[model samples]
Target chain A: MDVQAFKQRILPVQGRLFRVAQLFLRNREEAEDALQDVMLRLWSNRQQLETYQSLEALAVQMTRNLCLDKLKAHSRQKMATDGDFPEVQATTATPYQQVEAADSNELIHRLMEELPDQQRFILHLRDVEEYSFEEIEQLTGLSVNNIRVILSRARQRLRDSYTKANDYEADY
Target chain B: MKPTIEKLLEKYYDGETTLDEEKELRAYFQQENIPAHLQSHAPQFRYFANARSEHPSLKSINALANRLNAPEPNWVVRMGSWSVRLAASIGLLILGFGGGLVYNQLRPSAGKGTDLSFISETAPEKSLKQTLAFEQLAKTSASERIDAINQSYEITQADQEITQLLLNTLNFDSNVNVRLAACQALARFEREPSVRDGLIQSLKVQTDPNVQITLIDVLVTIKERRAVEEMQRLAENQEALDAVRLKAEEGVQSLNQAGNAPS
Candidate 1:
């Protein structure tokens, strides 16, 4: 596609795409790289881009795939580097200890990162991007009910993580 | 407002709130005043607000525009327009490299004259080794590697091995001149999918003023529509060289026109 066409059609949603990628990759640089790669791929296939049902959904799907691939590659690299060591769990910190930690922001950040891929993605699309259930369903190719279930689970996990962090502070 | 917000928050937790209801909940939490009992969920609401505020770097968008807009490289037009001067430069470059055993190895058939097409025909592994050599040389000085790159360009075509070497040099070569030359060499092979990708990728990591300018020029001259985004990015970077930034701005305008004009 031409520059004007690309900017008009694809550039508008880049922020959402970047946020979605960040949710999965959790690294700004990697997310940016993934976005650029996705954008380039879209540009290359511009001839067919118009054929897609929704360009925004297609962009999200591409970012999801790219981020998943990046996550897999990252895990493989981690495995290679951390041979014989068990993976560290994010929740290893005792509930009391996590609450005692002063930075709730960091706690929430870690908890969000530790969420299941699908749940985190759903949470990001709904809560952060504020996309409609129909839009989420379209983008994710999951039923609206399934998305609501996953999103509800993600919210519960966040609320639990947040309360656990806060309750410790309240107790002490 | 408090009762309504509390109800919406409950529904939000259950993922039962409509988008408008959730938006209402978000707006309420963003307000300065909140009942003490309902303040507990403020952080999660604020997190969503912060996340929504997060934006992709404009620089990336500009780079994307730059890449998508760039016209497909016309090898025939480019080669025809500059072959003689390019050949002369290559002759000088080969001499600069001291046409030694390496040159002999580069040209297996002695009678074929000085055409560099044979360089592209060289074993792919040899070019990979050349790229590796460049990676090691990057530690010493990019200046030292500049001559090696110039020599390589004279012989190497747009083959996979040479493209990798040029890409590495473009991104990692410390010397601006070497990177600039790499940009030029890569520009010639922009028709190759790999080379095109390498050039686009180089724009992200490249920081030097001269290399950035050369890369921008190559992208614009080739009518790379996607480069409008990168040009926009360069134009926006306060730290970028003023001249380069202006050039990028001008490129964006011209490319925008070119891309938008009737095909």
Candidate 2:
């Protein structure tokens, strides 16, 4: 593909690619960097881009792989210096403490931050991005059945935590 | 209607619901008065809805695309012509040196005043760094602009141009981190009246809560009394974030107290 074709086909997917990077990297600057890197890769391989059925799926898969690589490198550096792998801590707070401290949206954000990386990515893809199971399977290389199981677990976990937090407020 | 929703919720949890059913669930939760039992699920759906709005700046993407598409220079042809260019540059250097020697011989009085040359020599170096910083600030990458802001610290003199550039960056940069860096850099020149006024004005326009809070803190640190009114407005503005509002309220109180106290 020529430059104009590359821009038309690949440039528009950058927003989705950025979000995918942000989902894995969890930092805006790094996500932007990852997006740029993925775009560059796509540009170099533009000749073969038309062969793919979906450009967006290709962009998303590339973003996911790149972010995972960055995360792996980051954790390796952290491990070398800190001598321990970072753990995801469940930050529990009293219902009253959070009621006035953060809005419900912020509360949900904190809860989502605690989710495992796979579940978080799957949930975001399925719900916010609204990708069909087949599309998600194409992007993630997971069987549709496996994707559903992960999605089910992610949703239930979010529901349970969200209810536990707000149920206390309902009592008041 | 409640029974149907409950059944859909079951299907949702089991991952059996189609995209349309999930959309229905999201739409139902968006209503103001959701049933009490279903209230807990509202935030997650709201989060999904909000997440769709999170997007990267397209301007930066276009900049990246343009940079990638720009043609690469033909280095092979340039290398083939390098010998002629090198010979031309050497001859020009010799001619410049000979002309400078003759001019020096003809104007012997010029050497007596060393201060003039000293000023001329140092002035351009300062402006050179400033010029480079100014150009870097226009680049699309956030980190490059941040590096430019850091470079501004080396420009020892209090320059009006640098101050204005930093103010514009603090006020209008698309990236939050770049704006934050500009804010911190501006604080170093708080003694300048324009810097002080520019920061106070910035508080009125800044929408990001982090930038707003930082501006408030910088204003309070610099003790700009005029900022107290802006802080009051921010505190009273219902749309401001809760954390920002609280900070502004605190800022108003402290500035008022500072005003009443004797130095």
- Give the whole-model CA lDDT for all candidates, comma-separated: 0.75, 0.79
Give each model a TM-score.
Answer: 0.51, 0.50
lDDT, candidate 2, at A17: 86
Candidate 2 chain B weakest lDDT stretch, 10 residues: B123-132
Which 10-residue window in model 1 chain A sums to the lowest lDDT?
A79-88
Q: Considering summed lDDT, which 10 consecutive residues are worst modelled in model 2 chain A?
A: A81-90
Docking level of model 1: acceptable
Q: TM-score winner among the candidates?
A: 1
Every candidate's fraction of true contacts kept comes to 0.59, 0.67
Per-residue lDDT of model 2, residues B93-184, tens digit only: 99999999989886766664656655644554344345435455564477767777777676677678778888988888888998999899
Per-candidate iRMS values, in order, are: 5.2, 4.9
lDDT (10s digit) by residue, model 1, range A1-172: 5667878988888999988887777766677889999998887788898889899999999999988998887573311111111121224556663343224445566677778878988998999898899999998889999999999999989988888878887898
